[model samples]
Target: MKQAVVIGGGVVGCHIALELAERRYEVFLLERHSRLGMDTSTRNSGVLHAGIYYPADSLKARLCVEGNRLSREFFDRTGVQYRPSGKFIIARDRSEISEIEALRDKAIANGAEGISLVPQDTVQKRVPCVRCVGALHSASTCIIDTGDYLTTLKTLLMQRDVHLLYECPALAIDGGVRVETPRGSVDADIVINAAGLYADEVARMTGLDDFTVVPLKGDYYCTTALPLEVPVYPPPNHGHGTLGVHLTPTCGPDVIIGPSETPSRGKDNYDIETPFAVFDDSLRDMIPNYEAIRPSLREGFSGNRPRAFRGGTRCEDFIIMKQPDSVIHLLSIESPGLTSAPAIARFVVKMI
Candidate 1:
């Protein structure tokens, strides 16, 4: 049997391992944590992006559109819990209407399905609490049970007899064929580095150091105050790092808000450091009746985004690099990553 080793056990790593195993490769999945999806996978908003936010020709746009479809199909086949609750990207003022139009056009170019521009009155009738001049309704956007999804993927890999080593961190790599882990040295014909935050460090081990992973922290708050029917977002932050603070309906009763973008002190920093007032201001701008639920807000969770930077500029597209010696590295896969995990896995295996 062909031997393969995959580092990192997040959603992307797990999916890649599964795909390789299906192709008759002996796969060894390494995870630093005791379990999978403990880091960037399960944290933050679990919304399956509809490929609307990225540039038209970017890898993120193409992968996200394909991933959305593949993910929903996987969830349906495996009985994963997810709500096909659509999304509304609202324009707060006339100035932002142009932004919405641009996003709509980009969505069409990216081949995102079930997209349409809705008038303000239609939005208000469905979600009376939200205030907007216009909205881009995305019927394909869905909220997923992230924990369940991750668990399901792990189980599927296990059923295929893939070796899953937990708490086995990769300390070094030599010649792109052997990985030095704390437990022992693992040798394989092919090595895949899907280490989320430490992908740059992994790349450097193999003498490929062209980029760095900069960790950015985003904070979330949960509230039962808003009667929102679906996920709602403002226009993209443009050049900024986030998609702006907006409301998202979860699989549960609580609605989540405020993933305020801030410079992370470290990769493992998951504290709710940002004050509630910042979320309060952002919420007030999107939903005029936010004050009614201001008192109901509670400290939720925070997740770090492993943003990739090359030559001191933020890389907006996902980077999948293949070294000459049968080593593949997946770097800077942030938002839409969870949605695109399955498609990313298929792409990675095809590279071999």
Candidate 2:
């Protein structure tokens, strides 16, 4: 049997490992952390994207739509906890109505299902507290219990007899597929790198140093105020490198907000000192009574996105390509990456 080694225990790596195992390959998963999905996988908003963002021809657009469908199927088969909570992209002013319409067109072009533009009255009826001129409703958007989903994937891999090597970091690649690890060396026929924030560093170990991973830090805040029944978001702030502060209803009573984006110098930087005013200003226009609940917003946690840059040029789309010597590298998989994991696995399996 051919042996395949997958580095990183995030959702993407787990899916890739599972897919390879189903294909009858002897799969081994290596994780630097003690448990799976401890990094970017469980961090950030757990929304299963409806593939509304990204260019029409990008891999992100294609895989995200397919992944959204496949993820729901996986959740149902595994009995994982998830909420089919729909999402609304709101335009707070008349000037932004055109942007909302553009997003609707893009979502339709990207094959996203159940997307339509709703008038202000409909938007207010759906989200009572939201003050918007217009909105693009995505009815298929759902939020998954990321931790439970990861556990389900881990259990499935174990049932398939895929070897799980925890706390084993890949140090280097001596030969084609020989990975030197802290525990021991693993010689495999194929190597897959899905090492979240450290993907570019992992690639460098194999003499592929064309890309660099720039860590973008995002901070989340949880509010004691009543949670929305659905998610409410604004148009993405492409210039600031983030989807502006939005409200996401978790599986609980409280809501999550403010994944304010800031470029960081290192990957492990999880500082929580980001000014709340930034988030306050962004949300004031969308949430009518924002000042009344401003005191309720409290610091939650932070995460780092591994943004890949080649020759100082930022790569906006997901990078899934083969390098020399039968190695597949998946770099800079952010945003819809969680939603696109399954589809990405299928795509990678076909490439092999």
Candidate 3:
């Protein structure tokens, strides 16, 4: 039996462990937390996106579509509660109409389904409470109970006889090196690092060159009511570190908004004021005619997306290492990372 170790109990790590076990590898899922999906994975917008946002041929674009489809299926088989509560890429002003059309065309090229442009009147008819010049209706976008999804994945992996060690951190690791944990040290043939916040630190310990994981703090808001039948997103402003702040109606029925792009020096760094400021700016842009819509002040949470630590470095694909590639590190997995977990797992299995 081949002994493999996966670090992190987030959705990505759990799925990767599940996939590897299916491939006949003895998998061990190592988690620092006592429970799974407690960090970035559980706190995200939970939107299963179509492959519409990224530039053509980007890893984000391809993986997003493939992952979205795989995620939908995984939910059904595992009985994870999720909703195909489609989405609207709202066009707040006249300038956004062209971009909406372009996004629709991009979806076609990327082989995404049920994506099209809708006019202002149609948007108003669909969502009477809010106003828009037009909207990009993504019928494929959906919301899932991410925590439940991860729990189900963990259960399934365990049923398949995969070993999962909670409260275990990969203290130090090198290429094909033994990982010393709180529990003990174990030699691994393959080490999969899906550590969301600490991916860079884990990678560095491996002695690999050419990549770093920078932690980006995104703060989101939760509304008290069911705001929309589906999520309400803004037109993509390419080059922004994030999709502009938007509203997502969670599977739980509470509407969520504002994952404000706030840069930080470390992981899980909490700052309430930054999200508050960005929420105000976002509300002004999307809901200007708003009274009931206010800069939502609530007990919102924050999670750090692990990407490149620098401003200029942009990574658009999954970095899988096995052979000279015996280790795979999933870094800066934010946003669609939740949606892409299932497909990313499959891709890693094939790569090895």
Candidate 4:
């Protein structure tokens, strides 16, 4: 059997490893941390995207739409818990209505299922507290219990007899076929770089240094104060950096809010906290009585998105490049990554 070495134990890496193992390859998965899904995988909102945000025909758009279907199937097959709560992109005024209508057109172009424009009265009736002109509802967007999903994936990998190496960082790559970790050296027919924030550095070790991973930090807040039944978002932020502050109904009671986007000090920097005023202003825009629940908006966990840049220009789509000696590098896998993990694994395996 051919041997493969997969770096990073995030959702993407684990999925890739499982695919390789099932294909009859001797798979060895390496992780820098002690557990899986510890970084960008489990952080931020756990919303399963319906591929509505990206440009038509982009890798993100295609994979996310396909992945959403695949993820729902996988969850049902594995008996993993998830909430099909859907999502709402609301326009508070007439100025934003055109933007949401455009998004509906784009969603149609991207083949995202169950996307429709809801009338203002219908939206208000469903979400009484939300003040909006109208809303774009994505029926495929759901909230998955991230921890449960990861645990289930891990169990599947173990069942396949894939070697799980935790706390073993891939320090270097010799000739793109040998992975040198602090634990030991591993020789394989294929090597996959899914190292999340450190993927660029891993690529550099193999002399593929054209891309850089810029960590975009986002902070979140949580509260049980909002009676939101599903995700409530603003029209997509035109800045292309973030989706702006929105409220997500978790699988549990607390509603998550405010993944305020900002530049990080470094890849590992989560110390920079955003001001409360930022979230307050954003919440007040969508909900007029936001100040009443301001006291309940407590700080929550933060996550960093591994945004890839090439030649100082940001790469908007997911990068899955194959190199000599069967090395595959996955970069700029943010946002829809969690939703696209299964499709990404199948896509990477096809490269072999």
Query: Backbone clashes per model, in order?
Result: 0, 0, 5, 0
lDDT of 2 by residue, 6-93 (tens): 9999999999999999999999999999999999998888899998978998999999999999999999889989899899999989
How do the residues 257-301 of candidate 1 rate in per-residue lDDT, one tens digit apiece? 968888899999998888777897888898777777789999999
| Candidate 2, superposed: residue stretches over 4 Å from native | none
Tens digit per residue, CA lDDT, model 3, 1-352: 8888988988888888988888888888888988888888887778889888777887778888999999888888879999998889998889888888888899889888898888888877767666689999988888888778877887898799988788888998744557889778878888888888787678777765556776677777777643577688888646655787887877775777767776775776766446366676776676645556563446577777776642456675555554246787777676678888888888777776
Judged by lDDT against the true structure, how good is candidate 2? 0.89
Which segments of candidate 4 are over 4 A away from where they belong?
Answer: none
The 0-to-1 C-alpha lDDT of every candidate, in the order given, reads: 0.91, 0.89, 0.78, 0.91
Clashing pairs in 2: none
Q: Per-prediction TM-score, please?
A: 0.98, 0.98, 0.93, 0.98
- RMSD of each candidate relative to the true structure: 1.0, 1.1, 2.1, 0.9
Instruction: Provide the lDDT at 126 for model 4.
Output: 77
Model 3, which residues run further than 4 Å from truth? 295-297, 309-312
The TM-score between candidate 3 and the true structure equals 0.93
Which lDDT value does model 4 have at 209?
A: 86
Cα TM-score of candidate 1: 0.98
